[model samples]
Target: MSRPFLKMNGLGNDFVVVEARSAPFRPSEAEARAIADRASGVGCDQIIGIEPSDRADAFMRIWNADGGEVSACGNATRCVGWLLLEASGRPSAAIETEAGLLQVARAEDAADGAKQVTVDMGVPGLDWRDIPLAEEMDTRGVELQVGPIDDPILHTPGCVSMGNPHVVFFVPDAEAAPVREVGPMIEHHLLFPERANVGFAQIKGRDRIRLRVWERGAGLTKACGTGACAALVAAARRGLTDRKATVEMDGGELVIEWRESDGHVLMTGPVAVEFTGTLKDRAA
Candidate 1:
């Protein structure tokens, strides 16, 4: 049966959202890869499946462009949240994922009529056990380095788990950082048993940061919402920045706030609906 789908983007991180609440739809790894291929099929950073949820408004299933199923995706969450809110004409919605429950709310719309969304990413996990490193160590400063031992280019990165694992490296300049070269190395490092999302962050100010991320299974994306949240938390924990900051990414900016009182991280950004179409086959 042909199924309808929506193509959406949060910042420049795009997604192909399939609504399967009533009609069941699940794509295998190879099928997901085919659909996510830019040249062959509907191109997107991740393929999102919106399913029925007993505990929340809907369940969000995420598959990276490589067809690997992951626990969470913050940009996809915001895009799905906006769709739910617009459909229900409500102010908020709850989404269930492999990571956990996420609370999302509608913010004031932009002048261009695009709706803004804020997601409660929950508290970050700072323990090595939570991040599931191969060995135990202090998450604030993990023992890892790259480049020559005498003069390492990246070293002592902070680790955190925002649904998924993340290792943030504070750099002198984000634009100049070797993201493509070093990101894969760190992601597959022996210490990170489950692999990790790598973030290169440059503190522009107490309230601003410039960041680029190499996402696990997805390689380098235009923007990574969870990476932005992780960067702000890691920056604040290291005394490099405040609890809240505007993270400037290659695609756009995201406002991330680590709430001191509740410890939940809030991410605010805009979502855009690029177009709509129908898929003749679930795999295609």
Candidate 2:
């Protein structure tokens, strides 16, 4: 039997979304890899399965391109939220992910025809135990450095967890950061027990930052929703930026705010539907 899917993107981080509420669809590791393959499959950064939820509107299951299942995905959460809002004709919606329940609402549409949406991404985890480093270390700045001991290329990365662990290194120039050289090394570094997302952020202003991320299982991507959220929280914790900032990435920009009142993070961004199709050759 054939399965239908929706191709969606937040910023430039694209996904192949499968609605599994009526029929459950749990892809195996190899199957997820095949579905996310750029050459042979639907070609997306992640594959999202939307299953029925008793706690929320829907349950989101996320798999990275490398076929590793992850707990949280901020950008994908917004896309799914938009779908629910549009379908239910409601002002807000809730989505249950492995991370937690996220609240989403409609926002003003972008001028470029891309739909804008806002997602309440829950609170960021700031403690070392929350980020869950392999050993005790300051979450504000961990003692991990790349390159030579005397003159390290990158050092003292701030860590945060949006369900999944993330490490953010502050750099002078985000574009010039050696993302390709050292990103993969940090993702599998001994410090992170569950592996981690790596981010290089350059503070542009009190309310602006430029960032690039090497996602744990997806490698370098145009944008990462939780990556942006983590970057903002880390920056605010380090006194580099305000509680709110516009995170500019390779794909586009996301507005992230760490609410002082509730400690929850809110991300506003654009969602684009590229196309829709059916999977005729699903892997068993």
lDDT per residue for candidate 1 within 1-284, as digits (tens), equals 88889999998899999999998778899888888899988888999999999999999999999899999999999999999998999999999999999999998777777679999999999989988799999988899999899999999999999999999999999999999999999889889989999999999999999999999988899999999999999999999999999999998889999999999999999999999988757574
Candidate 1 error regions (>4 Å): 111-113, 282-284
Q: Where is model 1 poorest over a 10-residue stretch in terms of lDDT? A: 275-284
| Candidate 1 global TM-score | 0.97
Error of 2 at 149 (Å): 1.2
Supply the TM-score for candidate 2.
Answer: 0.98
Candidate 2 lDDT tens digits, 43-152: 99999999999999999999999998999998899999999999999999999998889999999888787789999998899889998899898899999999899999
Per-model lDDT = 0.93, 0.93
lDDT value for model 1:
0.93
